[model samples]
Target chain A: MADITKSRTDTPTLWVERVHPAVWALGLVMLFMPAFANGFWLFQVFGWTFILGMIALSLMFLAGYGGMVSLIQMTVAALGGYGVAILGPSGVAQISLGLPWWLYVPLAIAIAALFATLVGALAVRTEGIYTIMITLAMASAFFYFTRQNYGIFNGYSGFNLVVPPQLFGVDWRQPVPFYYLTLGCAALAYAAVVYVARSPFGLALQGTRDNPRRMAALGFNVTAHRIAAYTFAGAIAAVGGILLVWQNAQIAPGTAGLPAVFDILVIAVVGGLRRPSGAFVGAFIYVLLRTFSPDVLTAFGLSNERFKMLIGFGFLAMVVFSPDGVLGLWDRWRARAGRRDPLTGKERG
Target chain B: MDGTNAMTSRLGAVSTGSALELRGVTKMFGALAAISDVTLTVRPGERRAVLGSNGAGKTTLFNCVTGDFLPTSGTIRLFGEDVTTFPAHERIRRGLRRTYQISLLFTGLSVADNVYLACRGVSRGRFSLLRPRRGDPLLTRSAELVEAVRLTAARDRLVSELSYGQQRQLEIALALAGAPRFILFDEPAAGLSPTERAELVAILTGLPSHIGFIIIEHDMDVALRVAESVTMMHNGRVFKEGTPAEIETDPEVQELYLGGGHG
Candidate 1:
């Protein structure tokens, strides 16, 4: 009777038993990566991947579960970064408030989340293409505002040397420590998204996405749910943004420019928007390509500037062949490989 | 002296007012009035049927009362509270429920998930981040609703996989979620098989006596069996109102609707 009541699609199970062996192996590899890899691989490659992955995961959370494709995630992240730089001590003494780390971190996340909630209230009023357009427009506005405003933003020559504080006699910016910090944060973000996907709020979000009118009839405030989703996604993106400022040791308008905003969307789509893990997978692929494509292009006697073209082609190929992203490709392959008659346990024709 | 009478009348309304009241409700689309000057009243626990032909504004009337589309002009009272301007969800929270004429279910979600969402919508903690524990009250309630709709065997299946009749049953279960004081069922029996229609009739007749409902059904058999009083509409206006027997026997009703082959 209990089994009959449970939904096969969303039933919660013991975490240890539900996770695949391959995932366990991957986790072990990530955990022990510092022993095998050098500082560059640990800090530059993996650190960047984790930060970008968290931001993209927020996008996946909204687009996959909420049916809202918001381009403002990257902007939210940048705002978070800017909050840290402006509130905490930085090279730009004129703008930096020189506040304590604990004080600035929560304040930064709150400001970004509040901005996202406001944007969500406006964006959810329209839907589909209009949502994308409105968020993109807001993102563009933020970019220009930061670039032009010297009062609070410090203008085009934004803050530099905005490093993470040394806590407990540990240099957090060290390559090994930074990798673990980002990996831990990214893992938490991923888990939060996965856990929330099965919560009542998440279920209702999917309901509103599928049928807003029916959801309203079911007594859900559809607009409020949608706006709340943006708030949650915004908080996740803000965390990524703070880490990103620490990673680069700087905060600039270019960090959340149009190109950067588009890159996060591309990463999410290429990874697959259906699951949280896809964000990390797509981020890893993007980081690998970005890091090596210049060398590969140069080796082939081609201009390194064509790396963007290469990435573009890769994105196009993924969309055309597996619009669900790399995960879709993997799923189809697994299905074909494992096809059999359930009753007979034999290969089916 | 006048204030005392007004207070007595207001208190009287709270105790004995109709379950649903529409006074001069009018809805217009451009130059066309879908339903104009429609006044209706249903007492507490009253089982009523709104019978109308196509374009007779039965659906339009349901939409107005449910707050799907606000009436262009007029007052709507739900259990004696003026709710003409309330949003759909607000009205639903106020013990009013409705089922769409066309099925409006979440096809991607499982049957249990669908019912769970309905149960969660009206209850508190709508935005809870925590998943329901085993044997949560709301989960148990949703399970009961699924069982009540006779979809227990298919509880794990998606709505898209359910048969047409099963989807219709799910629609009723969604409307029955929360403690509904009044329900508006729009063509609840449309496209149902004979067996399914009987099951629907049983469900409708089995509802608690305190919970009244207004049903708009094309099937006279099911409608007449379940509804004690029938309201007939023609050209968006109420042409007649009488008991099932009276409406069935009325010569004018026979010429315009029953004799026109709708029965």
Candidate 2:
């Protein structure tokens, strides 16, 4: 029994070894839903979840490991969306010559990374509450900049970019194809986040997070590691931005606004900040809530906008009650059930 | 000072020779001289102590050796390599590990986890995401260090839950985790009870001879008990260096510390 427990807990993967088989079955079922669901349901629900998950994964990498709770991940995603809209063949009045897909994608990623690096450069200098405030300030500034910049972003009225390129002559926007595309992007982002989280760089980042002075004494450059993490996270969020634009066939300042930015934080926190798996789980639950909550609220004679009250209250409750978030609660339940290995063991020393 | 002369006189005081050499090391913060032009050598396997009162620049000396602050003027070398300008991490990579005056374990983690973290090769370029940390060679080393410190009983306990002495033991274990060639202990017995202090002394004395140690201690008893040689520090300079008995009998050492003759 001890050997079995050790084998199950000691698996080299992330948190999957600890998950219940029923949860795995549910995930498998969800993955194949696009095959039966219509294009509207698939695109509006599953596609949005994937994009949100990818963005949350980026924030998870920075906040969970790097000790930086950045509020500008959505802002950087918007930069990527605008990068293509303004630089690709989409802007009403193109500022410069539009670039090819290959060039535009890489350029947008780089610009987004640079933008995140600058934000990290400032925010990394502060710790705890100050970091959150600084990043939030940056996010607010980005939101307003896109809102007021009529020449490029078209003010509040954003441009509708052409759909993503047909891969092998198959329209990727179709229900099944687009769902697969979103899944592919999300899985790739998840893999990358997990990979980076376990890498030497990730260990160093966590080490700095654990004890920056100790890490500094150990010869790790704390600030450089933080900036690198921010840049890496930005690149991931930019991928989500590309998917976001692809999903909606549009890029608006509103999508990159405060609500969207706060939504990224909500996804990360709701999922849990401790692991990359938290991103998908959090996004899945949040997307489910977003899609169905309005109807549920209306049935109860509450305004749809007031659904935010529920979300905000739920978020506060999670933080106040379970500081580690939903995954933490799940882990606690599994630990009690003896069906999964608990993350609470020995804590890492 | 006398320690400089004694270092040259004691043949084979260290087998691996000097890992760190300080020459005319001085540090001044604003108007106050925290450390005067004090010179010292830490030969491999040598267990030396710097005995000083408060504000005697013992901690300042450590800061300079660890590269926490660049010396106002002078040179520092590790393994005969100039490291005066090297940063703290660089110094650490070069095999210098130190414990602070205050215990500095990662309080958020378990005691075992804190030790494991310290043992991790932060400066090593090899990092793998696919591999679990269980296979790490350093983890076993950390386990061994934890066992050696008698912390295996509370290995799973959070660092915050440990007793004060246990935390100090963990701090030393953390310093040892990196497998540094030399370790610096700053007032390791500062707040410990008599029994706790004695246990810490035993731990320090039992350390393997391959690792050099420079201990800055306020408690003369603990310092003299574990240290092979004790150097008295007075006003930021080495006042005397001798066996514990010799230093104990020295009039200047007594006057510097207690303002009286040896008891």
lDDT, candidates in the order shown: 0.91, 0.79
**Highest lDDT: which candidate?**
1
List, residue by residue over B168-191, the lDDT tens digit for candidate 1.
999999998877778999999999
Q: What is the C-alpha RMSD of each candidate to the true structure, in Å?
A: 4.4, 6.7
Error of 2 at A174 (Å): 2.1
Give residue B21's lDDT in candidate 1 (0 to 100). Answer: 90
Instruction: Write model 1 residue lDDT over A1-349, tens digit each, in one string.
Output: 0132343336666758767799899999999999999999999999999999999999999999899999999999999999999999999998899999999999999999999999999999998999999999999999999999999999899999999988888888999999999999999998898888888998999999889999999889999999999999999999999999999999889999999999999999999998888898899999999999999999999999898898899899999999999988998978976897777877788
Residue-level lDDT for B240 in candidate 1:
93
Candidate 2 chain B, run of 10 with poorest lDDT: B1-10
The CAPRI-style docking tier of model 1 reads medium
lDDT of 2 by residue, A134-153 (tens): 99898988778878888877
